[model samples]
Target: MDSITQLHATTPEKLTEAILDGVRKEINDLKKEFQPKEPDEFLTRKDTAELLKISLVCLHDWCNKGIIKPYKLGNRTYFSRKELVDNVFNSNL
Candidate 1:
């Protein structure tokens, strides 16, 4: 029931560029909508990866070693945006 599922077989090679461009545009729009008045102060694994410019493996290792603690929600995990920003700004990494 994916809306864009039809794009796979019907789309031309050039359609990939167009599709990607549209997707990027939508993501940028969403980002603007989520811009916090202050700060998010929390983020997901993918968000942490983007902020740290590191792979999930490295983050996982740090979590295991207790270098940084994660906020667990049931089986899910996440990092604090404040913690990451503070660490980066303080040159902890």
Candidate 2:
């Protein structure tokens, strides 16, 4: 069952303000409930190579030649899946 309530406003401006306030509350609630996805997915060197269908040697070479970018943490390297897909789509070949 649903219950309806009436909103009373003295002036048009007050009515507009009340409506805007309700909208703002709804927007705030949505914002609170929203869960944002990760901006980019990180991949390991081997995973990245496998995804690109390239061998480890070739992947390393591409990284060395600046064809593919790599991020290093400690002794490990990572690549952005989004960046790799973008490159594949944008490449001439």
Candidate 3:
């Protein structure tokens, strides 16, 4: 006969600590993923704006019009550096 410890009763302090620890771990994992393990060209909207010397609004508009497509994930949009470079350098701009 074995007695089981019931973890269904969670103290507020313990719950908070557990939540914070989980969040911290998630943040650390996100940081690692964002650190770029290789030479990649994924750029955020801000990066695209700076690279193209264009406004965020303009970029969003262009993306919407399909002039320059954007990759969306959840709520974030990404642009490829190669595409921007090709557009800027290869074009008559």
Residue-level error in angstroms, candidate 2, position 43: 0.4
TM-score ranking, best first: 2, 3, 1
Candidate 3: residue pairs that collide: none
Estimated TM-score for each candidate = 0.51, 0.57, 0.53
Model 1 scores worst on lDDT over the 10 consecutive residues at 2-11
lDDT of 3 by residue, 1-93 (tens): 999875778987898999999999999999988886656588999998998899999988888777787989999999888777777558774
Segments in model 3 whose C-alpha atoms lie over 4 Å from true places: 1-39
How far is each candidate from the true structure, as Cα RMSD in Å?
16.0, 8.9, 13.8
Deviation from native of the Cα of residue 7 in model 1, angstroms: 82
Q: Higher lDDT: candidate 1 or 3?
A: 3
Score each candidate by Cα lDDT. Answer: 0.80, 0.88, 0.86
Over 1-93, each residue of candidate 2 has an lDDT whose tens digit, in order, gives: 999977564777888898999999999999888968669989999899888899999999999888889999999999998888888657974
- Per-residue CA lDDT of candidate 1, range 14-50, in tens? 7878899999999999999988788557778888887
Measured by lDDT, the strongest candidate is 2
Q: Which residue pairs in model 2 clash with each other?
A: none
